[model samples]
Target: MSHDENNAVLFGSGDEAPSNHSHNPHFNELVDARRRQILAGGAALGVLGFLGVGLPGESQAGERHLPPFGRRNRLPFTAVAVGRADGISVPAGYRATPFIPWGTPITGGYPAFLEDASNSAQDQAEQIGMHHDGMHFFPIDAQYGAGLNSRHGLLVLNHEYIDAPLLHPNGPTVVDGKRVSAEQVRKEINAHGVSVVEIRRDVRGEWQVQPSARNRRITAATPMQMSGPARGHALLRTRYSPEGTASRGTQNNCASGFTPWGTYVTCEENWAGYFASRDSDLPRELKRYGLRSSSRFGWDTLSGDEFERFDATRKGADARADYRNEPNHFGWIVEIDPFDPDSVPVKRSALGRFAHEGLVFAKPRAGKPVVCYSGDDAQNEYIYKYVSRGKYRPGRSDGRLLDDGVLYAARFNADGSGDWLALDLQDAAFQQACAAAGVSFADQGEVLINTRLAADIAGATKMDRPEWGAVHPDSNEVYFTLTNNSARTTADAANPRVKNAYGHIIRWREERRDNSGVRFAWDLFLLAGPESDSRGPNGQALGADNMLASPDGLWFDEDGRLWIQTDMSGSQLASGPFGNNQMLVADPHTGDMKRFLVGPLGAEITGITATPDFRTLFINVQHPGEGSTANNLLSTWPDGPGKRPRSATVIITREDRKRLL
Candidate 1:
């Protein structure tokens, strides 16, 4: 899912639709030390405790107290078994209702959906786009109190990308080396972006979308500003913005993040291949990000202002006259003020861009700098953290706060310890290392533009496709999913499995239990595989009960329950007992995991968020019936027979209306 669009994972990267990972050396020693620690009854050796954390009733920074995370968020539901159902499977007493599907109108300007799939590009702009992904709900101030109506909130979610085969009337029609239909191209263009619509629960507790002026769509053509060190760099100048201050569109938005001040962060993952660069002397960063000779969608093959923009090659005299720098504007964390749909999305450049899996904040202190943790969603990629230079006041604006921050790449040492190396080009060690690698770092912007290269220069640990990250709501401890890497030829102590196919979870504690720290301790939380391979001392797998693979979408509910979602490929779904990708509940405190819901065929269960009351939960089903064509459909879920399989969001709740465990 991280490398290519057609092969695997979910609709794109990051497991869930709107969703959103590494290790390092000290190699054999780290492994030997961990093994010794485990044998000495230190299997619980991960950096877990928070020495600086203050308990409830004590003077504290915020309303919540993270009382040693994992042990607190336990669930009481029974774990479901694997199944090969053609439709999604949920536990008894829990009902899953189809909430919103692709093409649903969110604004007054949008037209009703057409089952024949003949919606216009203009129509999609006003309607809900395809492939719903990571999302968050921001309750308005008036309805913010508990026991109040929890439905009147802005529902913000990512439309990852379209399912091409089903999107077009008869698939994409190609003619004369180009798409024969201009309207189809327009439809596809409008289909990719973020959707913010207002939803409300009625007196009967039924959630429904209502038309409002606030309903808006931020698409691939919308204008966006660049915010950090890379904002006005020479490499970012393009025909659209000669000063390199801004760019258009926010594509490949996978996972999402919500700020304490009420802004939504939409991350761009796997955005490189969407552009085409034909220059012979393209920058190393451009080629490394996978800007190719032609885009997979081939939108560049068509002619017109809208279509030609997809071609990022240098066709004019210089960067100012061409679109060569267009791709550079992407691969960032785009922050949108969901409450203000008319507001412009800002590309927070301080967060060094890679295949941005998602963005989640480290727990904040009353007057301390805000911290962010993210993973580069690719095989053997590195994880990153951004510590803002400015302190975030509880009521101060959260937007633009990410503009000035120190981006750090992680380096794991052998003895369960790690360091966050600064990706600063001015650092003497960085300068020497860059010189040795035959790379030149002229300024801080260059380091951010060439983040992957900078990380290499910094000796960061490579991970097995790090995906979504979930920070404990109370503790701020981080948990990242190292989604499997089948390309590994040799196994390392940190990445235990050779030809690692099943993936695992890695958790780390910040130094002194503070979010803003340069050092930390780490450990492997779970080695995901078949049930047999995950067995324990008594020959039984899991002290609780769960067998899964490629852990992708993850989130920590208010009550501290860690939700684990699977992202088995369409081909990999049948390879083991881990049937079609599903959602599982995990107890970080006890390391107990249980299966919750299993999705339909050819789909990945992703994008989950809950209402404040926890009585309503939302999860997205991406690319269901993926390989099926119009004539030979694979599934009929959420809809009756004879309809195209759609990427949709499912609302799950207890039959008794109890809070989600």
Candidate 2:
């Protein structure tokens, strides 16, 4: 996919504290008073309707056509106006605190963050990484804030990419076609992968990271194990992992998923852009995966073979000599056990490989296989799901079930119905389809390695740049953001707009509510745009309160409030009404949406999570002032003026310590 904006954490205390705790007594009192006011209004309206007069929201028959608010669904808040603010803006009753910015020291002996944007590679590795994206918080069985496991936890976050100029003293320098600084390249490499550090709240209720032995950085150079179908495949036979059972680092991590067993799954997105392959005969799998000439960052330009491995071109007589297979090692769902920094992150190949945005599991049922959903965040790509071959056993993190699974790609039919086409090589139809396309899929390994091609051959439906997918905490239904596909010339029934720059959300329920079921029903949930009433594919228009565009990050809080985030960059971000990639909340049933929070200029609101007690919320503001260059500075956020912009996480809480609706 071309350069674009995108999408993402955890908690503490082992005592199983009460899920409901209002730390801010005033905020609770205010919220309660607000609820009481609404109740009184409802009573007045009921009486008016009984007197043959109409209520404010009533239909002619004294009944509402749409679902009522808070029958476990509602957006009971005022929508904030869009603006080009240079900082974050939350709801009237909410307050925000900045925490864990890039290059913030997470390990010992790290230099203080240089406001001028000069930090060494080694120093960066010892600090919080740059471009924070998908993240999770794994509680360490201790309690600190709000007296409800509010403080102690491992905060595992992804550094999707870096601001090259800002990361180096004088920006990246390529002199006579050769990088002048290995330290610079190393810093860029060290700024990515995942950051696992301990975080807790203090007596003042402010969240902060407390460095410990568990604080570790997994960069692009970290060793990663390859498991599943493509574990030992010939295509993965690189010099480092000569046995083809391992690879180094995960790159371009975007969104993420977490397993009940406590491991975090970081998605590898836009990874193919890192490799350069000018040879047309370099195999279709490589070409199909978007490996073209002229790599981004050009990390391989740095001196010596240590940094040159980023270039995935053919070299030597066999695979053991060069990094051609390195690209194959990426694009798969990677699992990291945050609880154990010593545990090697694994590439679960059975999940199938693609531009994985996020891996979200359906509520795992007893005696049933664990199932999860993922979206290929690229133009015209397909949605996918994985079903473990082994049954899920509660309280077991080492399920081994992830080592074996069945991967299926979605085929969204026009009649509000869809099918999950099996992507297994053993499937007769898939075998014939691959054969028809002149592809050699001899085993499960090939199928998983070239999953997109398999999906294409199986006639799986192409989507409008499917981004992040999240399963509802209560409904067990899945929702994914199709983040604006500018490539479509003709409308597909599932994606109605020919050039859908303003994205829509598509949701589906599995047949019989079975996570592994093939058949399903789907409908457009929200049609995003600047218009007050934009109609979805189903001809349902969202009311004035929900105007938005390019929906990217999405998640459901424990109380079932759906949080919506946007990534409207390019011209849209600078001038569009959706303004500055705001975060909003939606009532899934009634279609009520309100802008809950807005990020700083040139930033994408992503990586969202909440405390189990719903007392606090965390969201990442990535690449703030992304429009700026090293010299042309655009945004200076978190700390105002004269400092280089850095991606950081924002902590929000209701004034009364109650859960945000």
Best prediction by TM-score: 1
Tell me the spans in candidate 2 whose CA falls farther than 4 Å from its real position: 1-73, 142-148, 397-399, 536-544
Give lDDT tens digits, candidate 1, residues 1-661. 2222332321233232111121234232345545544323324322232222232222332122445544443567777778777787787788888877888988756698887788888888888888888998777552234424467787889988777668877667655444557788888878988998888888987888877888898888889889889989998998888999988888888888887677889999878777777877778778667665756666777787677777888788888887788788888999998877678889988898788989988877768888889998877678999888888897664766788878888887666677788888656777787787787877888789888878877788777788999998776778898888786766555555567788877777776444777777666667677755552212235432578888999999886668988888855796666788888886665555688998988887889888888889999998787776677688766686899888888989889998867
Worst 10 residues of 1 by lDDT: 14-23
lDDT of each: 0.75, 0.73
Count of residue pairs whose backbone atoms collide, per candidate:
14, 12
Per-residue lDDT tens digits for candidate 2, residues 391-507, read 887765353778787899887654345678889877787788778778777689988898887887787776777898888776676888988877556544334455788887877
Error of 2 at 604 (Å): 0.4
TM-score of 1: 0.90
